[model samples]
Target: MIAILSDIHGNLPALEAVIADARTAGATAFVNLGDSLSGPLWPAETADLLMREGWPAIAGNHERQVLTHAIERMGASDRFASERLSAAQLAWLAAQPPVLALTDEIFLCHGSPRSDLEHLLHTVEAAGIRQATEAEIAERLGDTPAALTLCGHTHLPRTVTLADGRTIANPGSVGLQAFHDDHPLPYIVENGDPLARYALVRGTGVELRAVAYDHLGAAAKAAREGRADWAAALRTGLAG
Candidate 1:
């Protein structure tokens, strides 16, 4: 079976927990959707783990940021400075391809097909989703028919069936969120404890799983790194 993951955003502990879960569930292959870097946690370490574990991954917006930085260092200054990526991290990110066609009928993207940074929310209309799907196909596969598109960016887990019968599966965020109230514990929380969102994809079926991990440990690390906002979000699974 294949384990699909995305939007990890450098939460090493959470990613480790998810990897353990996937292994326990017998996933032989792993497909990472994108956005593997850009957080308070170990970005380089996360990328190294994925590479060592042989997980196939696509490039996300953060990866683009790394590329842009490389261009800037080469005298092209149009890059986004907010990334603050290290040279080694930028090199690794630049090595990743923008898109990957997993099979004749399955595709993986960090965000929308049109743009790796675009957010394809579950609440979007069918027409919009269809348009995005077509744009993705044209840009990457060039008329190839894909039965399913797996993506993660909105951090909202969803399965949307389009009018043309195409399926879009969002496994949600492994390190962050795109939904949840301001409360301490929201809908998916277990007895007021926060959990990490994940998914396992086998054949045409996608099983969503939210596993609790060392939230306090992660939060403490984030705080120690002076990323208080990220630390708070880890504590509640609600992005500020």
Candidate 2:
């Protein structure tokens, strides 16, 4: 079995819990869909763990921002992680591909096939974010021939099977459960709980799973760092 994880965002305890749970579920191989260390909790330690694991991984848009943007211009989360990551860790992030074909039939990307910042299964408009229509997903997907495509960016666990029988799955965030984002527009994503999330791919099906961890401890650490917003999200899975 293969386990798919994404948007870890530096919460080490949550990642550990998800890893243990995946192993228990008979997952022998792991795929990491990135956004791994761009948070206030444990960027350096998370980097250490992920580096040791050496899972097949891809880079999210945050990875690009952290690597190329000047420190002064980076968002607070990216800046915190960038500051704490070592040169080796940064190198690892730099080396990750924005899109990866995991197998002849399994494709992996941080977001859509064309843009790391675009949501593969979602659309944003005047009303805010909503599930992407089949046409929109097809447009973003282009002509990728993979039977199964995996992406993670919005931190929402979802699976969509197109009318053509192609499947797209997002394993969701192992670290963060909810957050507000502003780019082309403003939006919020919330899973409504503090458990870490991932997906198990067995046969041709994907199972969305959540695992319990010491989320309060993580919240405390974020509070200590003066990230009350992160702390609130960590504690309640609701964006502050």
Q: For each candidate, what TM-score against the reference?
A: 0.77, 0.98
What TM-score quantifies how close candidate 1 is to the native fold? Answer: 0.77
Candidate 2 clash figure, as a count: 0
Q: Write the per-residue lDDT of candidate 1 for residues 32-150, one digit (tens) a residue.
A: 88778667777767767876776788887766765665654521111322244567656666777777788987887777676675555432342222234544433442343578788
Candidate 1 clashing pairs? none
Clashes of each: 0, 0
For model 1, the local distance difference test gives 0.68
Best by lDDT: 2
Candidate 2's TM-score: 0.98
Error of 1 at 79 (Å): 12
lDDT of 2 by residue, 1-240 (tens): 999999999999999999999999899999999999998999999999999999999999999999999999999999999999889999999999999999988999998999899999988777778999999999999999999999999899889999998999998899999999886699888889999999999865899999999999999999998999999999999996
